[model samples]
Target chain A: MTSDATPALDPAVADRLKRDGNGLVAAIIQQHDTREVLMLGWMDDEALRRTLTEGRVTFWSRSRGEYWRKGDTSGNVQHVKGVALDCDGDALLVQVDQVGAACHTGSRTCFDGRDLPIVTDQSVTTDGDPAALEGDARG
Target chain B: MTSDATPALDPAVADRLKRDGNGLVAAIIQQHDTREVLMLGWMDDEALRRTLTEGRVTFWSRSRGEYWRKGDTSGNVQHVKGVALDCDGDALLVQVDQVGAACHTGSRTCFDGRDLPIVTDQSVTTDGDPAALEGDARG
Candidate 1:
């Protein structure tokens, strides 16, 4: 299905987008596995449509008014895991599996050099293993 | 000198923030090493001051209008690397050295479990190896 599938964006959602200038919301996509942000882009009905259909991340290009696939050329594709809406629904939080570095620059993650520590097993386990106290998280 | 330097917010900066609301801006903190997103929070003059002063991540709670120090209770602290302002100077991109999980739920990163692959060379490497940082970053 395409954005056309939805017929039209919900009026309430459209109203908020109107305040932002048009029927567009900013979507911030992040690498789900690494928690690294891949990219930030705009989304309209059509872009949102392609994202759902293609299984990859797509965005509406405001400057060109065209659909942008995340890795169309760079190969740093973003695979969509889930898309979430902010309380206002005017913004989107896109969770994705990033193929590689998301930025045009040669960085591991779009947030390269941020220098954050790996917190995979802090409280759950002191020795790289999840403790029984934490139980088995389905995740 | 560190994340805890409490400098008076620049007057011009404060004025700009006040014009919009107060000396408050949204800080998008991303993990430096993994490039993962940790969290999104607001920053007022005081929070900004604390972040700069403490050399740790700090944000103003829009809901509470108070300071929020990352990892204060959870040990998922974000060590400040750098701060960038958008053209409007109303938003901040904070690059940090995040310790442990940025999210309260204790995932490796706030973004977890998306599935996209950036095709790369045949030789697979470990997760944090510098050589495999980006797909085409072979050296």
Candidate 2:
């Protein structure tokens, strides 16, 4: 875990993370309150900068060669709670306060209907579908 | 997070979650030890059933119309620690003990090489990279 009050991340460490073997490090987004992981994406320097500067998570798209910020299009923005680096300084852990659904689907998170089911109210309901991002919403 | 012995989860809730308009939900995998999200995939009832029964996480591939068991091909499997459904029953939280690298790039986890630069031992090093996963020896 990273120290809460550090001047800034080491410039060298930042450089290394950007160059992980595949030219990118996959970002892991987790919920601050629940400690549940919400989504995963690729991140480059710009995305990391935007995430830190903007207080929202951003990722680099190797295919698009662009920055993909959470909620840029969909309303599912992931708020940054904290950031940590592994002992090897080869990975990142982003604690976020996700707003709205983390997945493109209408569900509140991206991991909807994943490992287990949650009971809501008197009835039991499953999570929403994320495919909606490619469906009518885009249309 | 849901308890380890949560009475098998209600079927009605599972059915509702399985219907995310497209009969799939995004399954986000996070590292139980580091709390870093590793990857994102889709899941169906069968996938969920397999994961629950096998003690490893599995998902359905909407693009391929098949079941995807993480580390099936690479040997980097995600061991389940705990699974939780969000309050709305629209998302899931899976705590896992990840093995090897989660990203296809072959790094230890997906959050590697993500543009997080830091100084270590007076040298700058990157995080996860293609080289990290190129010849991962983990089995």
Candidate 3:
């Protein structure tokens, strides 16, 4: 739970993010040890700057139009371990030491709860591979 | 594989995605069976529509500013099996039966070949329990 500035991020690397149109890029949060993805958030220049300068994960809330640091309200803080820029530079893989539940609904991930329903439309009907379409497309 | 117009996605579900700022949402691609995150792409309304209608994953390329379908040129096609909308409606979890390497570098995922460098900053130092930091932030 180190809160000092300078986590596992390279300032030069963060600058390479493509934040052109909306001054934002998608930050994918993953659990440091398990590599399980917790959640995704949008980060602006200031948000990335703060995240690098301040260790704790900070995100640009689109709905609120403000900078919200993780764990400011909930104890679910994400202490960054390392930050990796995707080859495309448009997305980010943020490896973090997460604490508590990552989802606001008390789930471990934002992807839980909802089961992806299979569409019986042409796309699925065309594929007769019954084995590949399990567990929300698990094969 | 079913290359016809149908894929494993529901159009109505995609319609629920919120496309306010920049008219785009972060589309996170995940491997159907392996659960490995392949890549992240941006999807506008048109992109989402095409993905649902056509069955192949289509993304809005920010740099090129065009609708690019997966595997169109690279041969790395993401045959979508399922699509999930985040509770906030700002992000998407796209499960796909991917073909070939998802990354341009011939890697299975865009996050490969990088070790998450650890930082001795306050964030890591505050938490002394190494046991709790297992399972990608799991105790």
Instruction: Give the per-residue lDDT digits (tens) of candidate 3, residues B10-68.
Output: 55666566775677888889887777778899888777756655567889987789999
Which candidate should be chosen as best, given lDDT against the real structure?
3
Q: Model 1, A57-111: lDDT tens per residue?
A: 7787655778888678988787765554444344566767787667667665443
> Between 1 and 2, whose TM-score is larger?
1
Local accuracy of candidate 2 as per-residue lDDT tens digits, A8-121: 433654645534444554465777667666666666655665565556677886556777877878877776655555433434577677888777667655555543432222
- Considering every candidate listed, which one attains the maximal TM-score? 3
User: What are the runs in model 1 whose C-alpha is more than 4 Å off?
Assistant: A1-5, A8-26, A29-139, B1-7, B12-24, B114-139
Model 1: CAPRI class = incorrect
Residue-by-residue lDDT tens digits, candidate 1, B1-139:
4676545765644554421245455567776656655556667776765664456777766456577787889887787655544433444566777777766667654434321122223433232343332333121
Q: What is the C-alpha RMSD of each candidate to the true structure, in Å?
A: 12.8, 14.1, 7.0
Worst 10 residues of 3 chain B by lDDT: B130-139
Per-residue CA lDDT of model 2 for B1-139, tens digit only, reads 7776735534754755623555654465666666666655556666665555556787876547787777889998787655654433434556677888877778765544453322222323234443322221111
Q: Give me the displacement of residue B134 in model 3, in angstroms.
A: 10
If candidate 2 were superposed on the true structure by all CA atoms, what would the RMSD be?
Answer: 14.1
